[model samples]
Target chain A: MQKDASLTTPAAIRKLVRAGDYSGHTSGFAPGFVQANLVILPKQYAFDFLQFSQANPKSCPIIATSHSPGVTDMPTVGEDIDIRSDLPRYRIFKNGQMVEEVTDISDVWRDDLVTFLIGCSFSFEEALIAAGLEIRNITEHKNVPMYVTNMPCQSAGMFHANMVVSMRPMKPADAIRAIQVCSRFPSVHGAPVHFGDPAAIGIKNINKPEFGDAVTIKNGEVPVFWACGVTPQIAIANAAPDFCITHSPGHMLITDIPNSRMAAL
Target chain B: MQKDASLTTPAAIRKLVRAGDYSGHTSGFAPGFVQANLVILPKQYAFDFLQFSQANPKSCPIIATSHSPGVTDMPTVGEDIDIRSDLPRYRIFKNGQMVEEVTDISDVWRDDLVTFLIGCSFSFEEALIAAGLEIRNITEHKNVPMYVTNMPCQSAGMFHANMVVSMRPMKPADAIRAIQVCSRFPSVHGAPVHFGDPAAIGIKNINKPEFGDAVTIKNGEVPVFWACGVTPQIAIANAAPDFCITHSPGHMLITDIPNSRMAAL
Candidate 1:
């Protein structure tokens, strides 16, 4: 998969994914644009998830949502985002367990299904890279390591779980600069949840992350952690409402909005 | 003695000081404007001091400086400002040792003296107060507690010294908010340098600070430390130039610019 050449534009990439031509990971695709973590739920659980996101904005910054329960086109984020088939892959869950992975969910899409577009780390990562900081996962060609921490997310209704965090190894100096840089982009998991020790957050092993591949931790680098998009997924898994769908890991929905537009400052 | 009533405007206060009518501290005076820390040096050392300030901006953010060697009017910060008599009191130092403290320095003014206006904590203190955060020094009617730290300032030319920091006791939650608030106003000794333990920065005694009066540190409150304007003063002391003049402690020059004008964001 030539990430640089194939996916230059969001609409062009979405067309390929919709046509079943491309179905691999979407990291490093559509540079300078916002990519989102997708969460599709039945109308019965949509209100609870929305409330959960509102309670924990730093962990779950909601970018946009479907206008109606069945409406798929999120006109605000991009031109024609068909929530059911635009993504590269979808994971179908039944009673909180993954049932199957499918290319399109049009067969299972119901009239009462709702789609949520949550802000992902790609935007802020681009900002950090632009500021001349090296991301360990990107450099090592591995997924950014993620861990489920003891820090619990504020529960709204039946939606509740402990927060999940993504880790990036950086020296203390770069970590300080990263804090200042990310503080400006509140919509994309602003600042960091914790910096230094892994045990402080109840992570027993720095090498064994709960999700994503472990990247190299250099000599002077401390693992800097940010509240991850996987948090809402964890909450959804806990709630487990009959049926739900989400993009397979790394198959994000790229939007037309540029990454810089997300900076709150 | 009535701080709120005595100093209504910058010009009026300058007039009173010029006529030898006011000779006290300017801490509570000029309620809603910028009050600066003054350091006057010979023309030979002006460029070096300016470079030091530029290198250590968090400690010494320069608001304005004398256009030339002996010119008095700092028309940029205030109008018709006689740097000799505008400040309440001036300390004349010969080879870095204090020789005299006088209400006016006109008779001793030289052609080679250069004036610098460094940003003081008063502006951000006002902002913190407006945000409903209590300033311990202001509440207790004492000078803000300051300490000499192991952290060394970037040296330039003959100017070099360990950094000085001012401490304010705040709960962890309040400290986080303070960091966010102070980040907006970069000129006025922005965001804290270190928070949790004083020993981390080599401050042996938290209760007994090196420079200013000690304030109460309540239960569950961690000492938040900011890079102090005294940093430049310490550098100047180390440099020990032939002669220098500076505003007496707490006797700053009240500038015409409003405090709100200093916020970078």
Candidate 2:
């Protein structure tokens, strides 16, 4: 925890990961900076993936992407980013299946690989906490409960799948406030898509999630669902791109851009 | 309905009301202008009621007040406005009990009366309609169902009572959109206070309401509750002021101010 507190800046955290010193999840590290989900794929599938992101902005809001196919410097999001080594962990997928989990991807770096930085929930979670709302996952010390809903995403070329959502239990009053707070950050999955009955969205059981661990839902609290960053991953896997890479579940690429800069209003 | 279409402007509606030509409810008339709730109290009770409104803004957001006692000219809200006869109808109360209902209060006008213009839900209702969300009350051709909740209002001098909330039935997805739409108009009760189960807010039966007509709650729809303008009236009645006047339930004081002007953002 002390080490976590020491890595306060995005640059410092990226430096630690680049030096092979820190290889853990980047959840609470670099508090105020924006942490993004990484999705690297061969340039052959870049246009279709970009179209899919635009069609489903709520599920996959794109913040920035590789300047050209393998040029690794994302100056728009960070100062000097080495896409292969800046993140703590990376997952390599071959033919729609994860083949290897590695600390760095320098060995498999391809000139035609396109890096995508999609917005993550961590930004809005930080905003919600600052507004004095309790996130159930944070309180229970577990991953936010994620589920694949019957709500389908708009198809783009060959990329198409059902939307994935992450749930957080909140009292109705708090949920109302969360909507207002999240609405300002449209770049990060703006507002919740649904609340109340989980079965209404095709979730048979609230206790059993398909993707992440379930958190406690108190008596009066309702489960509010937001379009998760994981939706694109599911779509990508379903598309069965010949080669692709993504940051591991909780690990993400910390950016120099402040979360406040993402506000729409 | 043709007459309503003719009376499209706020000034025209106020003119008709002032001339004793139109004495009907102002809902759906003068669509874009702000319609306010009227609360006229004697100078002796003005300070306490003002304090009460300030303490509970969500329930009683004050848009304007008379410049001074006996001064009916509210130039800020409109041009040459007469507080006594501008509304379609008025209700007079004596020692907390309703004594009479009339079209014009000029006959009983006093030099000690102070006028208070409060924000009404009509502003946000317009916004919801513009956003393409159906307002159940409007669809059913009934008054919005309102219930007296266990939620307590902050006590101010000689003013204290339980809160009153107006309910609108909507699907969870539409309810989420309503929260965002209403949040922009804080002067008109802002966002919904509670949603889902009525028992959570102390309403025993969803169909039975203490005030206004109940609207239908469809199969997948949930009851969304917002702090109502009636809350102030309830508090004032509970306080039992020596003499007071207010607009009749559906009769509002139409102002020249546009509905968009009420948006906080």
What TM-score does structure 2 among the candidates reach? 0.98
For model 1, how does the per-residue alpha-carbon lDDT over A1-36 read when each residue is reduced to its tens digit? 565665699988888888888888788888899999
TM-score per candidate, chains pooled: 0.86, 0.98
| Model 2, position B92: C-alpha lDDT score | 99
Write model 1 residue lDDT over B1-265, tens digit each, in one string: 5455656898889888898988998886778999999999999999999999999999999999999999998999998999999999999999989999999999999999999999999999999999889989999999999999999999999999898999998854466567777888888888778765687688999889999999999876768889999999899999999999999989999999999999888
- Residue B183's lDDT within candidate 2 is 92
Q: What C-alpha lDDT values do all the predictions have?
A: 0.88, 0.94
Task: List the DockQ of the predictions in order.
Answer: 0.22, 0.93
Over 4 Å off, model 1: A137-142, A145-154, A169-173, A194-224, B4-22, B132-156, B167-176, B191-210, B213-225
Candidate 2: clashing pairs of residues:
none
Superposed Cα deviation of residue B34, candidate 2 (Å): 0.9
